[model samples]
Target: MSSSVTSPERKKIHPHKFTLWVAMGSIVMMFAGLTSAYVVKKSQSNWLEFPLPKVFWYSTAAILVSSLTIHLALKAFKARQMGRYKNLLTVTVVLGLLFSVLQWMGFGHLQQSGVQLFGVGSNPAASFLGIITGLHVLHVLGGVIALLVIFFRAFSSSRKTYSPVSIEIVSTYWHFVDILWIYLFIFLSVV
Candidate 1:
């Protein structure tokens, strides 16, 4: 008789992983279509030229900070440092909220700066900017909700036994959203 310890074949995937991947892929496609349209429409005629809002730079910096905080939180979770993980998660959540508020203020600043979005079919560029940022804001709001869910979950006793996969997934999604915003900001700024 052959005395060999055979390892079980690894299962292909859990259902949750499939769902997460599908969601991520959908988000990628949505942003890709938006950016492509932005590029195409920007090349056309009669686009208004206005100064980009100063608040945008502040919002970018806030998002970068938030990304770092979430990364630290992930690392802490992996290391089993529950205290540090909680602290970092709190900071990341705060930063995400701050980014949203800054983006809102940026829109207000644009209005105050006499950058009209739409009037008499004028300022097409401003209108596009509003639309793109508005859509981005909606996505960011979703991210904030995701973060809140993660935050509340961390407080539950069951959370101690839960795998860090959900937290990691949220971090990945948040970072993707942040990078997308940065790309859109740069694209709008230059064009």
Candidate 2:
């Protein structure tokens, strides 16, 4: 048999990884649609603009730090430093929770200032801000759940049986959400 028959021309990508990439691509498209609509909607005279709350600034800092922590956690996992990995995972969860809380506080701030999400007085801009950020929060919550599963598994009886696939998948998704939040934060901040 020829060597070409015995071996493929190129190694195949992992299916799970390929699926993740597809999902991420879809997410990018969805957000692009949203922001584009926002841009178009903002041109109307009814669009309302307001200063984003300072808590959002604080939340952005927290989320950025969380992304760094998750990167370190992945490294620790690869090093087989179970203790460090667990600790880092816990920290990431805390940070994720803090980010969501801060986002909720931002909503409260907007409401207190009379920026309603939906009403006769609510403008498209305020609605877009609320809907976009709210969707991002839900995605962040999903990431937090995945982190918790990984965190618990790290301490379970099967701790000796390390599966990099699950960890890697979760980490990839977590990083995606972090990047998504950063983009949304910048987008909302600008227009």
Candidate 3:
């Protein structure tokens, strides 16, 4: 009797998600260096201190809410509840936009409070704060774009497959940015 050939299926890595991970790893390393420098620079006598704006707290809340909505959206997608998924995704997108607005408001507050972002009057403390947070916003923007793509896809005719990979990957990223902001906020507030 001829034995049937058996071959195990190899797990295929999602290219977009794989690229995101690699990019995130680079981001983590970049932030690590920035924070390290921040710590070292904080010890310097010339390091000027500034209070973090209250609007940042608002942004934090908005981002946290977005995280929840995205999670719900993912569940909805997995359950094949397309309508609920669309609504949740829309809410998440709105929340993300709100978070960005709040962050901008916080930055404006910083400027109003005399924490300049550049040139002559700029302090190391404020500079580092702006740089780190701005970099994070760039990543968040990327996530927002990804979500928007997913959102549009959900509305398209081809959405019936309802695969959870893309949504889950973006959810991971959204939560990462949320947690990263919280960590930075606490770090700046304390140190």
User: Who wins the lDDT comparison?
Assistant: 2
lDDT of all predictions: 0.84, 0.89, 0.88
Model 1, position 184, has a per-residue lDDT of 88
Candidates in descending lDDT order: 2, 3, 1
lDDT of 1 by residue, 64-154 (tens): 9999999999999999998898899999889888888998898888888888766764477788788788888888888889899988888
Q: Which candidate ranks first by TM-score, i.e. highest?
A: 2
What total of clashing residue pairs does each candidate reach?
A: 0, 0, 0
lDDT of 3 at 103: 85
Error of 3 at 150 (Å): 1.1
For residues 13-108, what per-residue lDDT tens digits would candidate 2 score against the true structure?
779988988988998899999999999999999888898989999998888898888889999999899899989989999999999999999999
Q: How much does candidate 1 score in TM-score?
A: 0.86
Off by over 4 Å in 3: 1-12, 157-159
Q: Local error of candidate 1 at 121, Å?
A: 6.4
Please give each candidate's TM-score.
Answer: 0.86, 0.92, 0.90
